[model samples]
Target chain A: MFEGGLDLSGAAVRVALPELQRLTNELLRASGLQVDHAAIVTDVFMRATYRGVSHHDIYELPGRLAALAAGKVNPNPNMTIINKYAALENYEGDNGLGELGGMFIMRRAEQLADEHGIGLCAIRNSNHILASTPYVETAAERGYIGYIVTRGAPTMGAPGRKEKVIGTSPMGYAVPTENDCHIMFDACLAYASNGVLAEKAEAGESVPAHWGLDSEGRPTGDPAAIAKGTRQPIGAHKGFGLTILGEIITGILADGQIIDEPQDGTGLVGMPSHTAICIKADGLLGARRFRRRTTELAERMEARASGLQLPGQRSARSRNEMIGAGAIELKEPLLARLNEWSAKLGVQPL
Target chain B: MFEGGLDLSGAAVRVALPELQRLTNELLRASGLQVDHAAIVTDVFMRATYRGVSHHDIYELPGRLAALAAGKVNPNPNMTIINKYAALENYEGDNGLGELGGMFIMRRAEQLADEHGIGLCAIRNSNHILASTPYVETAAERGYIGYIVTRGAPTMGAPGRKEKVIGTSPMGYAVPTENDCHIMFDACLAYASNGVLAEKAEAGESVPAHWGLDSEGRPTGDPAAIAKGTRQPIGAHKGFGLTILGEIITGILADGQIIDEPQDGTGLVGMPSHTAICIKADGLLGARRFRRRTTELAERMEARASGLQLPGQRSARSRNEMIGAGAIELKEPLLARLNEWSAKLGVQPL
Candidate 1:
């Protein structure tokens, strides 16, 4: 979110969020997506922007449109529930936009939870879901606990191994609190994502030592070497283990590709898969009690802070600070690019 | 298990595993447990030994017996299902041994998965469950993808705070493969467990600089300071986020204690709770195909590993190597203490 735009001195331009959202929706719709699907995908990207995580936001819009033009994504997908059970289901996405599929499956999972206390839905053949936090946060917003995992293209290597055999494999878990405040923990298993490393390399800056390895599998602080080689997991074997486990559940179990069979040319592997889980908080502990307890937990942790911060705390603060301002900061070049795309796609410019 | 025995000239003695198992069961039963419950507890501990993780093994047996003696643990518990849903259930453990409750819940979860393609069970008021790996592995062995989380005694601190607010909150996830092998990923969220840190401190060794903070929340390499202060999470805030999420689901959702409400020195906060999830892997991917794919993934990784090992690979190897050895290693002092306990409890010595 902090570092995804072209260099333009040290100043960031403020742009109205509504205008940006409208531009995103218009561009996607003009780029061959249905209006509803465009809205869904646009919302996901925009949510990242509002949360100051533009790294996963509309920054990827151009690439997504390129994928759509290349026929890698089906805008009008006839998604179907291929298998169903009391609390679990598997969906075939027909290679639709990942955000649409993710939203579709998450909503279904919540519905299943409403009927059965807990629900799980696995989706395959969905293009890259930009981020998982929003999907899980959606469940938390609906007063239920949510969990989601999406297998990305393989770029991470196994610990001590030269072979790249896993995706960043991001996962998210969220628990709801009162006032719509939820604790959402979303992270990729990799210590650093390829995008971040590439950005560092472009800036000619050194990365953290644990970020990745060189071609020889030796840890390096050189960003260029890391970008060319492979990203490492956060906790060595532990994170590697989690990444593989995620691939098994979200990819293999969904009848999607694993790292062994890499998809060529496509920025994303063939319609990467995802798993969404929803738990009825009220079903476990009465909703009121759970909310009160979460508030107490958060307050207690805040009081104990010696400098450490909770997840989403910074994002929430950033969102609150910008709400009244009516505009969000963006790299000038990115803003210009969005306008160019709007002109090229015959959509109204921001 | 690797090393939990008392010092014995830097070497351990091999004792017949059956003999150790018999001794453990005898002591637990003599201390007040029913024979079946004792066997369940002994099996969980012995499994850790077979996997070369003696750190969480029978070394805890004496203390468990002490808890029973002190009436801190209920030897004869009336465990019951307090709440039930289509694919979920809450069990009241009535202060029973955690292993017994874990096994019960895992089996129930598997059954639920059989009926609903997925199942989840939460248990409350159970004594310590040695490791979640064995419990989730139990599900994998039954041909289901599994997950388990157990809240331990609070000893971990969140980011920025000097107060210990969360337990290591160990969690495990496993997927079954062919050849009856499972990829089991079990880990505590902390950078290092207290046991490991204490071991390092005892050996007059410095731990990793980032392992934990001193009482004042300043980073330290002295394991003693870390043990006395607060332990840091692995991957910093990412691990902290996970530990908090685990507590929410496994602890708070089960009506158990959280960091904010630190229970008094009862060794464990009131009957620590756990959550177990089992997914019917065959429900998503056909049984044969899923098994074959898992086998292929493991084989591919093994072939490419340049010293990087897959999770559970070493454990499986250790287990196979010891199966026919007819004995297992233990620190001489620990073995002697166990013998003394056997005699003190009027049970036959190993």
Candidate 2:
């Protein structure tokens, strides 16, 4: 989804990270979200922004606040474990606090993996988790291989099908390396996420024909058509195949809501499903040996790759840069939208 | 790895299933492999041919036989489970039977999942497993989600790098469905396997520029150049990213030999590594509920996809048709090579 290196500096605003986090959290609480839930959302949003994933960052605040104001996101959730197997679990997310649910489930997975060799949990009835990286990174910090899969609102079509029937269904995977560098591969199954297409549209550029299809299932380069139509999968039918499996895991196995058809006019948010898996590197390979081999493998790959930038290198670099600067820059339109939400909720804007 | 479809019927020879299997098994045994080891190889080869994946079928028999003679593939191995955790294991293949190792470990995984909900094994020092399908299909038959990852000899260059640093590193996944059909996604990270390119070369056709590169790492449509050089990964760096993870799982975790650079003109088959994982569907969702939901989900996907065939549908169709015919077709050159090996070993040909 990393396309269109748009130069939006002229139409952008820089906000201190702490200040922005505080304001977003306050806005969510003002909009009737619980304090802990707002904190979780704000933390995830700020991290996404710092990593240059602004589409899922504070830009999503307005929609989330609206969902909360409408009582679609339950402020207080009675999260509980439902189906419990030795290393597998099914959790009821209670239609509330997706970030909380994601963190809680992943922590449980880590706990189980500490006891067992591997652990997995399928979660349902939650709102959007924003980004999947935090959950995975948390496991990586504990020297575990972490993975997250979640179904989102329907925005993509099956291969060669005219209608949309699948969510973005993003996947996140992380492996810890030496010296605190972690490798992560997080991406949506679509050729490009809707956010990337919208960015191209805003920049007045045509997308690649393979990105999405027109309303008639024909490939189109027009970003407007893509916005109106649906995304094409990453690798044609192969990617659609993966998306189908993701649906079975996140939707059916979790007993979660499946998006049978799109909700066009409804303003209410729909509950999505998620699954978290954690594999203990220490348990599989002794902790020290695993750590050494992990670094050695990454080094071997880089040495073989020569000039190629490895996966997650860019994100790590971006995060470091943003942290050093202590501020994150967002496009002006997104900043205006955040300001509008603040005003609507009668909260101070950053 | 689905790209150019070549018509190889002109260069093909049809052989009865029983005769071909017998000849192949005999050839392996004559090459110093044990009877059971030969049987495992023959069975996997037959399955690949039935599914129309002839590249990894009997076409690979000559290399395997040669590897056996040269002590690259051990005829008799003392396969051992080196490390065992609650539901995870690390196996040393002893440079022996990959198909056997795959089957034994998957059966172990099944047994583990039967008790603990999930089971996984990372295997090292094995020869090529030919194809990952049979192992995964075996798990699916027991109503489990099966996955396999393996590191092949380096055949593809990383993004922006000129050297071949990665393998086809295929990922195989399978899930059972109603009506005795199962969904299987088996594909390599490369745009196409070397076997497909070799087929194109044999048919005197040039490949697409996106398929592979020349020695200089420039994209070339010449199949010969690709056979001599490296392949371009599917979806550019994204596929390469996945390959790196596969390496970490199959190579580093299993402590298998990793291909650092291309070996030119060695004619030595490098031992590859594999990992198999199985998750019991019934453990997460009740057995009956999982079965019902699996079928319902497949039906829903088919309805939404319209005339677009699902991923594994083509292979299932080909297999059924081939089985009904009671014969499998091999390209004439491959068949000749198999017969030549048999004759050299003083074994009867089909």
Using lDDT as the measure, which candidate wins? 1
lDDT of 1 by residue, B51-150 (tens): 8766777777776777788887888998888777678888888888888898888988899889878888989888778877778777888889898888
Provide the TM-score of chain A alone for each candidate, in the order shown. 0.91, 0.87
For model 1, name the residue pairs that clash. A306-B160, A308-B159, A308-B160, B1-B49, B1-B54, B2-B52, B2-B54, B125-B271
CAPRI verdict (incorrect, acceptable, medium, high) for model 2: medium
lDDT of 2 by residue, A217-245 (tens): 78898887887888877656667777877
Off by over 4 Å in 1: A1-11, A198-207, A262-271, A306-308, B1-5, B8-11, B160-162, B260-271
The interface root-mean-square deviation of each model, in the order shown, is 2.1, 1.9
Candidate 2 chain B TM?
A: 0.86
Q: On a 0 to 1 DockQ scale, where is model 2? A: 0.57
TM-scores of all predicted structures: 0.93, 0.90
